[model samples]
Target chain A: MVESLVKEYTGKLPVKLLGELKDKLTAQKINKTRAKKIFETTLQEYLDAQVAPGEAVGIIAAESIGEPGTQMTLNTFHFAGVSEMNVTTGLPRIIEVFDGRKNIATPMMDVYLKAPYNKGKDIRKLALLIKQSTLQDIIKEVNTDLMNGKIEVEILSAKLDDHGLAQAQLKKILEKGLKGVNVKIDGSLITLAPSSKESNLNDLYKLKEKLKKIHMSGLKGVTHVLPVKRDEEFVIMTAGSKLKEVLELEFVDETRTVSNDIYEIAENLGIEAARTAVMNEVFKVINAQGLTIDERHIVLVADMMCVTGGIKGITRYGIVSEKASVLARASFETPIKHLISAALTGEEDYLNSVVENVMINQPIPTGTGMPKLSTK
Target chain B: MPKVDPTKHILVPKHSKLSEAEQKKLFDKHNINFNDLPIILASDPAITHLKLVKGDVVKIDRDSPTAGKSEYFRGVQ
Candidate 1:
């Protein structure tokens, strides 16, 4: 009977832990019936730790995250290894997460590589490949010739060799990026002459500046890549995030690689990935400040954001605006707008949720209020 | 067009519409109005594959870490 019980829970419990429990029981000379009873009691205790029905999980989650949020100092810090990259952290980052901002202030990604690439070797080459370089990066100087109505751009030969870029490639990119300009490349010097039709000195100067920012090579949005060693694995940290393009790379580990931008993840992967990103990002900020909040609370917040099949912020214009009850919407920010709009639409407030019920001075439909006393 | 499988998604719970008899039995057993129950939109992906229309009942089977496997019923709105 003991052997049968162990077989029953083989996959459910860790094999080593189960074996230890069985050995402990056998050493005590406990009978089969008693062992089975003990096992059932343990299982019941584990199950009972789960949340009860009608629990106000949303309010609890809000408090759990909000309390820690107040303790965080409002500060934006530069990325450790990369001096040019600055990321918004602490309270502001928390706000950004809850608000579900589409374009994050500092869009960044922690890109993990697959297999041999994740090891220390060949990370520098990979970082250079991922870091987006523009025309300005390889150019020594840009000079505008007002009298000639042309722009002279000096290509740094050393810089070009360092980045492994050819002059022909730059000329091709320039022609494609700027429509009404003739590109002429001679050795290490490139000149751009504006078309006669659009040849105001101001426009030529503007063209020179625009040409300096043209995309030359690497991922489109990525600005900088800093290779950092974490947990004995080499990972590239990019300044500007392009999660879709980054994931498409052959060497990138799709499962482990993630971006701090939540909406980008939703667009690239799906709502599920966005939900996980939200939870992980919140946890990272909270944990960095040496605070411990229950993981379940964070999970609840993520679930609320993703329940509608899309990521929605807990803001007046987002999830709050989409509430079914007019009263509920009015309780949130910009109450006049919501109430006036609802009045115009002749919308009805069913008062099903807590906010609407509380607004009307009624018992909220949760906990003891959930049960109705009917004599029928 | 190939149907997108909703079950393969991690966040989307397995869902199926309750039959008329089963829904009736549930309402009678709980002694509650349909609207009183929790709501899931008609456009929700979990029930989209089921082709559930408005006012239909969907049984959501969620495999929760804490609760093991739990079932929830929602009225499609």
Candidate 2:
């Protein structure tokens, strides 16, 4: 929260910088006591709502406030202390805690739980259920988009159906679309562009064959592994991917696969991006009806994308340096917040600079004050 | 909420299968509503996630792993 940001600006400071800082601090509130309460209550309420028959809902470390300026210790609430509770995203869920006496606030990470079916559910289960339902809804939108677009040929369009026929449809569509137009399929001798000036269909057919082979081999799940070089060791990392492609695969059930265990990053990405088709033409629906999703959940989705695609750090590349991790954790909110703040004051470049710095771990201009302004 | 019917195949309350009518009479004498108590389904996660109505009685196959025996129980009506 911004309200906690305070700098002892001397009288000699420029009025412009001073005004900008004031406006920013005014916009962001220093959520001291409330942040902890919110974290505790949200986690607790999430667990409470999951009461099952003959199961007990236990509350441990439910109300805890981290020391000011200190990062919250990673505490996992588990099922009788067995399975390590993953933080949905690789990153922790954080909230700012203020030191009343020192007037300085710092962020802290929190954890939740998930037990067996007969046992009461925890925060993790609630979050997972929410995330799955949300993605399923998005998939519906994507499917709607795919349906609205006409393939220009009835034969190609006929390839698609209600469920479990994507590959069959795609193969049929490809065959129909490339018929006497440019290619010929005689038994196994596939003649691609025997008459046309191009033979791109040959390559497309080969690729499709490979994908079909992999699919038929029961390779239902594909994981893209990325090892991040941290210190001396490489850490296995996760990312998000588009949900549309996985859903369209017919073999892959979008609902069952949308679990914390899977490294699916986005509701739509890569070849699946076309799922937005016609239904998602209204951008407002993606933003408004797209569910008020938690930033961590989105990051988890992003992690899945990274894992499934074997790509590393799409968030880092697409988002600025200073704000990359935060944006990855919170996804849309952090970026939207900064963009809105910048837009309101015509300081878009300055905000961009801040984001870059944050991404790269550089000292922010607003926080901890300026190094040059020190009085000897 | 769907309408609650007494005729539907509801799970016999635990008290009803307690060996005799005297036990059920005693439980009722104590002013405890056994029918309103939560019941467990044999399904791993159970009826909570199924979006079942309030009065729906889920049939559960109760099993004892150690005893190697199982019996069907109609959860409370």
Candidate 3:
């Protein structure tokens, strides 16, 4: 039993400690390479301390790095290389809600195809290449130009194909970079035109050939070509770019989604701004959901949410205290694990026994089990 | 009589280990007049269980079957 438990604990030690150590190193601005070295050395020291230790240091090192309580977001992010590629209406604005910021716009191609063109397509790979080649490159180019004090050119929509006109207004946008650009790639029909910039047609054709030279498939010396379908023309086109190179840009407004109970509480209390009032709203919502929260936790949340400007997911900054970050990580797995780990370290045999006993549905002593009627 | 203190000590009937003479001797040695002490159980199960009480002077035995050894716990009764 002891061996198995130790094995289990030791197995989790490396990975868990790695994450904690990484976070600590990130906060300290220790480079990734140095951080990895420290992690290995520290882990070795921890195992060594148990057997033959001149200086027992693992616990101290662990404690220093193992901050327990931090809130983390389950939210994934979208980065369009060009800032303004709209997937849907107000999609760019919605990205801001989830903390996105790269707003520099350029020609972005959003590929949509009819029926047969959809299967066996790795659109993500294509998106990545185009985004890497265009939007990110453009920023570097522009920034370099600005630093060198050179005038910037208005590099707009690249090219559009013929069958893409099937999209009507979307096709027109692709052609001219109107409200937005659209891109459609169908078989055997490559038409390149811009409604607004017919004069830039020569430039568009040259760029199209450059784009075709990109080997999207793993065919040696074979450049990308429009596939021809019998009686159906292949089409590929261009539009306004919406790729964001960086994740979470600056000064995007964040919205706090309050529960209806909180709204009701605020509406009734009419104290929208006070910190205490905010806590009350939070607790009211929590209670409405039939969950109990400790007053200390409430106070902590209030201080973080109201006073600290911690709007849900944006505060990926600052050093989180050891206790809080651990709790935060543990909470994601199991709050009970957090409770046990907080109450007792791995060294506490009695605590481990009690926890294990409780897990197995065995009879364990509590308040009323204090040797009632005396032991025999 | 230097304005004699009126406090008194009484012995509970259950703990009768201390004889009247022993009690008086203890009182005198401690400069505690009989009136200054409170009632205490003599030889009560609690006295033995915790091995303590007011004016306790007792010898307790500590024997462990696992270690197969014996030790002594001595205290004032």
Candidate 4:
């Protein structure tokens, strides 16, 4: 009877909500008459709770987000000692998301890996594999004596095994990578004393710089990596994001690996994913700040920014610039520039938006003022 | 190795182009114009397989966190 009865309100209310109502009704001793009354009242209340026609929801959403935003701290909060990645958090993160800035302050990625790797197996090696490693990263100290025409590099051999590196392999790499200097490996120490050419201080300094710049391992754009165990799985959280490159890795779970960069997401995954990222990122910051804004507000903002299939920021050069009303665009930023351009184009402001109407001292076509009455 | 598919990504929702009848019904229900709906690029990787042209309406079945499951629509551009 409950299943049959609930079917009546199918399109009127959400399926899940109706199912819950049906479950509640079935538990109690209720007749068909009482059940119908309950269903009818539920629908009535749902309708009553809906936003009234012509309500200015955009303004409300802005105020709701902005009010709590003022209290947020600017500093990036640190996770326990394991992960020292300085991810942009708080108010700055919110601004960055809304602005859709290409060069974000701290672009990071949550790179999920496949199988045993995700379960913290050979984690340090995996981290090293992902991290952009240079000769400088492994060097503990470097001593250069211009008098002896030699530069000795002391390696941190303690964690070399963790990075899946052996002394011989390192020696070979150093030998192949450097041309001017004769590379000599003595256990954990590497001595580069030029044999063919007598090198000066300047030549030695340039060689030192070149040695530091040698690309040893890892993908491009992923500079720092830390294997972090979250819940039951370990995720390789990286300081820099190279979504395309990371996704291409055999061990990486391409389906789940994600970058916080909105532009990167848009370029690779299209605008819908970019929109979702915007919403999720904003939600994460707001949630972390102990603020409770309705998720609808965030959703609306994301939809507005991504509605045109290209992600646009809320800034003057973005969403604001594309407005049909000249007054609206002028109001956002650079008043004279927009006004003059509108004049040149012979643009007519239809006064469709609230700002245009307010400029002309007309009743805004929103809530209460929306309906017009005619008389003969 | 297989190339990554944008449509199969976790963040992307299920997308399908609606029939003309379905589009008409949706517009009638919402009292909406084609321009009023959100716009999706014809070249969007998620919908490229559909071979949709500009002006076609797309339906997205999104499992939204706040509003539960909702069906959203966009006009191809």
Candidate 5:
């Protein structure tokens, strides 16, 4: 009986809400006649809640979010408890997200692991494996011998062992990476000699600098890692984001691991992911500052920004300049430039949007003005 | 380059193409046409697996906090 009643309202009400309503009616053990009455009222209420046609939702959403935006703090640094990580928050983060800036101030990633990795078994080792380790980090001392035209270095085995890197692997990397230089390893001491006898000390000295920067192990761009305990699971919080490489790791939970860099997410995941990131990022900043704003407003902004299949900022060079009307684009910023370009192209302004109509001192085509009456 | 599995990503939702009958029904209900709706590029990574043409409409099943499960639509451009 409940199934038939829900089927009748299938197209009228949302499918999820209808299912919930059916479950609720079944749990209450309501009769057929009364259940029909309840369903009717709910359908009526939902229809009433929807926004009407010709409503100026854009302006309303702008005002709703903009009003609370003024109270946000300008501070960017937030000390993340015992982790000793500095995360960008508040107004600066909000700007970073909306600007669609390629390079963010503080790039970060929270890497969730799968199975045994999340269970805290060898989690620290996994963190070490993901962090970028350089030759400078494991070397005890580096010196140049001008007479021999070579560079000598003393390795710190303890530090090397902590990274779980083998001496043979280090030697192999040194031999492959350094050009025209032969690498020799004796106990804890290592030496790099120029392959050509005619080579001067200047060439050997430059090779010493290059040797310090050789990537030893771990993924590139992941500078620091800290395994943080949240509830019963351990998640690694990285200081820098290398989302594509990190997601490929066997231990990483690819579905849940996320990067704070919006551009990185778009480049790796998709625009929809970036859209959600923008909304979540903005809402997070707003919530942290103890400000209240409706989710609908943020959703509207995010949808508008991502509607064109790519992320565009709210700046003059972004969504605003792409408006259809020449007057609208000109009015936003750099008016003279837009006007001249439009004139050169013989552009026409339809005055369909709010800005152009208002510029012409006419009835703006929004709300009451959207619909026109024609006599028969 | 490694191919991304669009279906497995958590950020993306279930997207399906609307048939001609369903598309007409949606347009009639909203009192709008194809040009009136928002657009998504054919090259968008989110729908790379869908293999959509230029003017097709896609239906997105979004699990939202405010409205539970909500529906969003975009036209391919």
Candidate 6:
């Protein structure tokens, strides 16, 4: 039966696809006749779902996502019980995802933990470990002595203990991060004196201000971390996103952990992961608004973004400007700029794309326009 | 060339480049030109493992919600 099925699909489909179908049917434990019926139905469904030649898929995708975007709210919402984390959702998020904004309004991460760590582990401790606690977080007071040109920072003993930071580590951090200053650690009180010849009273005040933002502990760029229970598993919801650094943690489930920032994901996990992130992020925002857009549309959009080996937003400056045809780019936005640039570069307008064809009032090379009659 | 780990993601469609004869047959059967088909870049990670040259036709086996599985073709650019 398998041999016969192979013979039937020999030239019709790829070998790997046929093998996969056979495996699927065999796994389902279907009888030979039943398998044949299933295979036929599957093939029919596949053919039916396929876009006909010249279908304006880009337009369809745009409309599919755009129409539902109208129903989306403009307001940002708190991520469930995670009060500290406000996720940018609705129409704004859709725009952000499509635009492929690098620095998102509220970059967050849903960090899943591995094994025992994901269970009823010390979630509070984990949250604290991920939250980026600066010197200001642990400092009781910061003062500058104008006369002596020295800055004094009194560390809160309790805050230091709470963050699990030793005085020695804090001193090291200060010494390494600070420049043109001498760090003098006297118990919980640290003093910064300018070692540079040009330093004065004004520099001391500036140093005091800069000292407050010095990295003390936890992952940098991660502002806050809130551990929430979802489906009986504890997951960390972070305010700021640092996917690469966070994934390096031993307890983190790298496969499942994801960030809202597409570029960061692309940079860390590769373009394929970024593509998935784009789709997931788009779905999340759209789904939150109680609107159902087809996943295929989002998939197409994500594919377009990552197809160039990097994420490029749907904005005019991004994917639009990169369009092959001069007229297509001109039609998008700032037509004169694109036209002039193309002219200067001696770029040829193929007029192959839908927009370029439409611009010149020619029949689009899609659907019936896709085929050209050739007589031999 | 290092093989692309297909098992790394279930969402990404499987990509394979067709031979010259297979590509010609597909274009003829579909009554379409290379430019008429949707495009996937030669740099696409999914097909990068294949080390496909420019103008090669890539066959993608995507798992569809409506259809159990479907085959789509893109001309590599």
TM for candidate 6 is 0.77
* lDDT of candidate 5 at residue A32, scale 0 to 100: 92
DockQ of each: 0.12, 0.01, 0.01, 0.65, 0.50, 0.14
- lDDT, model 1, position A194: 76
How accurate locally is residue A281 in candidate 4, as Cα lDDT from 0 to 100?
97
Any residue pairs clashing in model 4, and if so which?
none
Model 3 docking category: incorrect
**Which residue ranges in model 1 land beyond 4 Å of their true spot?**
A1-3, A6-31, A120-122, A143-151, A161-164, A195-204, A374-376, B1-77
Assess each prediction's global lDDT (C-alpha) against the native: 0.78, 0.29, 0.32, 0.87, 0.86, 0.79
Interface RMSD of each: 7.2, 25.8, 34.2, 1.5, 2.5, 7.3
Candidate 3: residue A248 Cα off by (Å)? 21
Q: Over the stretch A1-376, how does candidate 1's per-residue lDDT look in tens digits? A: 6688888876565455566678888789788889988777766765586567788878888898888877898888888867777889888988899888888899998999989999976787778777888888888888888888888989888777666677787788889999988999998889899766756878987897798788877797888888999999999999989876777777777657778998776765555556667887988888888888887788787777766657888898778867888888787788898888888999887779898888779999998788778896
lDDT of 2 by residue, A1-376 (tens): 3323223332323334345545654566536465435434544554566434332111111122112104333443332222432222101222101100111111111111112321332322222222212111112111111232211211222212222234444445445544443333343222333234443545444433332232211112322212233344322222223333333333222322221211122122211121111112112122333333222233233322222212222243332232423433334345677656556766534323243556668765442433346577
Tell me the tens digit of each residue's lDDT in model 5 across A110-194: 9999998898999878998899999999999998988778889999988788788888988898888887788899988998898
lDDT (Cα, tens digit) per residue for candidate 3, span B1-77: 12211111010012223555766676677687643443223332224444455555332221222222222211232
The residue ranges of model 5 lying beyond 4 angstroms of the native Cα positions read A1-4, A15-29, A79-85, A161-164, B1-4, B27-35
The per-residue C-alpha lDDT of model 5 at residue A157 equals 88
Scored by TM against the true chain B, the candidates give 0.83, 0.28, 0.29, 0.91, 0.92, 0.84
Best by lDDT: 4
| Decreasing TM-score order of the candidates | 5, 4, 1, 6, 2, 3
Q: Give the alpha carbon lDDT tens digit for every residue of A1-376 in model 3.
A: 2223324435434444544555576578765456556656776776774434223233333333222211222232222332333223122222232221223122222233334433424333322332323221221112112232222222222222211123354234333432222234233222333324333545444444443333221212111222222345222222332212111112110111111222222222211222243454444434443454454444434333322212231223221222234444343445676557667764333422223445556654443332347666
Order of models, best lDDT first: 4, 5, 6, 1, 3, 2
For residue A216, give model 3's deviation from the true position in Å.
Answer: 20
> Docking category for candidate 4?
medium
Among these predictions, the greatest TM-score belongs to 5
